[model samples]
Structure formats: structure tokens, C-alpha cells
Target: MQDSNLFDDSQLIFRVLVNDRLEYSLWPTVAGLPAGWAESFGPASYEACASWLERHWQHLRPSGLLAKGGGRG
Candidate 1:
């Protein structure tokens, strides 16, 4: 879910809630918008985002983008 027109004063709070597990929230406050507007979650900062991606890589795979045996061909 991406938001369009960031100039419209907004605050964005992206989160990761795992019912069985614990709720993990990721809301890095950014500036320049009014008060109720923001762009998509983020062009998240590098290191943290990279770590998250690495951890969830397998679970976030796109099946349609895979091949017969699941390799990206």
C-alpha cells in the first residue's frame, strides 16, 4: 500500500504485526510533509531495510517470478 502525493501533510507508520509472535512496528518519522500526508512506507534507510529483507527473503518471494523448481531463471 503506497501513498501518492506526499506534499499533503501526513504521518506514516508502517508496521509488522505477527499475531502468534509479537508485534513489531517500524515507523521512522520523516519530515517535509504537512501533518497528515506521506509517501509510501519508505525508501527505507539502507542497513536496517537490508537486514529485514535478508531475514524475510524466502517468505517474501514472488512465486510467479520463479521458475519450475523455484529458481529465478
Candidate 2:
């Protein structure tokens, strides 16, 4: 049997996770979602997740900071 790397394996499905800070991450569906993170996107291909992040997560700053008028000129 061969060991497979969940992150690199395209055969496996993944979902996008968002924390309170509004940071996004890609997580493998086979594993349990970490604390303080919720599913923002559905189970799909890694490429799809990447694309979604590119379109949605344009600003890298946390929502709290943005709310506080930070990261602005």
C-alpha cells in the first residue's frame, strides 16, 4: 500500500475554512475541521478552492483590524 499526502492528492476533496479573523484556509474534508474555523466553501477540487480564495480573499488583513480602520492609507 502507498501512503498518500492529503494536501497534494488531487483525488481527495477539500473545503475552504474561515476563522473569526476572516482568514481563509484550505482543509481536507477527510480530516476534522479545526477550532474557531467554519466552512466557507464546499467540498471541491483544490484548484476550485484556490480560485475561490483568489476571488474572495483579496485583502489579507483580518476583519477586526479592518473594522478598526487599520490597513488603510
Candidate 3:
């Protein structure tokens, strides 16, 4: 029998905030997001936002839009 893994084994970890009974997922947002994103262009400008994301790219998880696990590829 073969074992199945449902998620990616990437080292990246998603940043999450658990306050009270609510869980918050923190993600970088552009000045003008295409759609379905909360705008966060309050204080930081576009350049700053881009730099921040680049600096922390290693720590961010890829959007779970792909089937990522099984046997060795």
C-alpha cells in the first residue's frame, strides 16, 4: 500500500494570528488588488509593500490551489 500526503512538504509556514476565538490569516496586499482582497494601502506605499513581500517570500506559503502530495515525484 502507498501512503498519501495531502499537502505540500514545503518548508514555508503561513503566518496566522489567533486572537480570542477568531483566526486571522496575514497576507501581503497590493495598493490596488484585482478582486476579493482587502486594501491595505493606508501607510505603506507600493514599493515598500513589494520590498516587504520579497524579504519574507521564503516564509510565505503558496496558495493551496494545487494538489501537492503523493509519492516522490
Instruction: Give the winner by lDDT.
Output: 2
Top-down lDDT ranking = 2, 1, 3
What is candidate 2's lDDT per residue for 2-58, written digit by digit as tens?
998787776678999999999999898998999999999978988898899999997
Candidate 3 regions off by >4 Å?
1-34, 40-42, 59-62, 65-73
What lDDT does model 2 reach?
0.89
Worst 10 residues of 1 by lDDT: 14-23
User: How many steric overlaps does candidate 2 have?
Assistant: 0
lDDT of each: 0.39, 0.89, 0.33
Estimated TM-score per prediction?
0.27, 0.81, 0.29
> Which regions in candidate 1 have their CA more than 4 angstroms from the true location?
1-44, 59-61, 65-73
**Candidate 3 residue-wise lDDT at 46:** 37
lDDT of 1 at 26: 39
TM-score of 2: 0.81
Q: What lDDT does candidate 1 reach at residue 46?
A: 37
